[model samples]
Target: MNEQHTVPQAGRRLIGLYPARYRELYGEDIAATFAEATEGLTGRALLRERLDLASHALRLRLRIASTDPAGRILAGAAPIALALGVGESLYDQAWYVEDVIRAVSRVATRPALAAGTLGAYAALVVPWIVALLCAAAGRWKPARRAAVLGLLAETAFWELILGHTWQMYGEFARIALLAALVLLAPADLVDTGRRGRWEVTGLAIGAGLPLAALAASDATVLGVFWQSVPALLPIWAFAVAAALLLAHLSARRPDLFRAAGIALGTVPWLLEQLPRRVPTVWAATAFVVLIGGAVALGGIIRLLRRAIDTEPAEPA
Candidate 1:
């Protein structure tokens, strides 16, 4: 009886490595499975079984953290990443503070530059404010639209005023876009009832005003394209592709969508590490594309297989 009881005890101890919530729900099942798997194993074989269980448990924990709706992992992660990007920019451009203060001080002397500067900042920040408010209130569509508007505002500011050079500010703006996408892609948000046409028009108007002002300020179409496309296209492609993919998967496999979003959120940091960590931008781009594509493909395959398995086995 002592020897027979020891195996189950050992299995329970190993299963404790998972989170309290997970253990509470699945601990008994895990221990029972572990005991069944190792019933007759001993020595090296038993050690291997335990190691496999440990590794599998860790993976399961990571999977839960990545995909748990209660956790809202990607929803929270993207904003934090954006905040970090902003903090990093502020640290690097500490002089931007003095410059802003000086700019404000000379509002009377250099009204045009000062007004333009202030306007640029306003254009950039206001939409972010709108997005955050909408997101906080669970108005997902408007939140996403507001974030897109903010990106356009930033693009206009860069093209018309900042000479179109890439900078950390751009990174922060992109991160904001991703955060909005994260909010918009959740399965619950996707299942919400259709929005009214007027609501859609209102969002369009809200986004358009900033663009129109930028155009009036001589942010030409050609210049905006030249400045924004190279930097923005890849991000746009990935964001749209991932959002659509996740939205589709969210209907049936929300865990997959959330997990994929969490992975997508890491792409920016991976890209950032390329210049020094990787030999070339091309290589880094390929690496990201390959890895992202592979993961997406694998998940899609699994979803398809599950769908097939669930379909009533045809008229046989």
Candidate 2:
């Protein structure tokens, strides 16, 4: 047993350079891994490989703490890559399991999806990590009109051309929407644009176009691309926009519910006419709509409660 794990002190020291929290759990195991790496090593290349592992760990985890430079870059670049990958995957429909495995590497987070979303999350996150690196260097720059147009084209085209099956295409649409969110970044940060996106996403999800989607169906409309980029972006953007716009509107006209107003304004007219046209599966789509409406109304009430909690209460 001793000879099998005969890890040298310098190699162990290198691995042990990891954080204490991580080291306590993995230090011994890593020492064993290095012992294997150094099996024939007495050269500069060997030393370099050992240092590279430590360098990779440092670059990935130990940078700036504020605004999560890594997260930002991931958010910036990942969405487009996801759209491209899924588009490619669709292009290459014939799946070898090895290829399929590589394609959906981020599907569950872990190397394998047998565990759960946490693992899936890890898988989905690699590209976003790259995006975060890009964002760390500079701001995202894209034209708004062009972005909106690209989104419309992409979503509409996919909606039309995708195979007729509901399950596969539904996931496709949701993933496409996520791609749109990642792609549709604001023209500029108006101020300290740290937060305000949920309201925007809520607006998108709850406003006019929702009628089109009100009719429930089996398909998810969300294919798992390298999904993190497209998935969290709009919500993140929404948080930023909502915080800035609402803060300004509140200071200028507190009674107007500017957040809601902006949200309503952002809706497209086609969505407004969605309710009448939505196809019913159960003949009780109307009931589903009603239940959904009630849930939406309940959400507003909860938001009010949160708002009131933060406000100065009057003397009883």
User: lDDT per model, in order?
Assistant: 0.50, 0.39
The candidate that wins on lDDT is 1
Clashes of 1: 0
Off by over 4 Å in 2: 1-146, 149-156, 159-192, 197-257, 269-276, 279-316
Best by TM-score: 1
TM-score of each: 0.36, 0.24
lDDT of 2 by residue, 114-141 (tens): 3443343333333333333333323333
Root-mean-square deviation of Cα positions for candidate 2 versus the true structure, in angstroms: 18.6
Could you give me the TM-score of model 1 versus the true structure? 0.36
lDDT per residue (tens digit) for residues 1-316 in model 1: 3232445666766787787787778766777678888988889999989976775566456653335563354543343233222222322233334456777999999998887766765666677667655654556557556666766675675567666444544344455555544443332323222432222223333323433343335454555542242323233333333443444344544555335544554455434322333223543464367446656666677778788879997696
Clashing pairs in 1: none
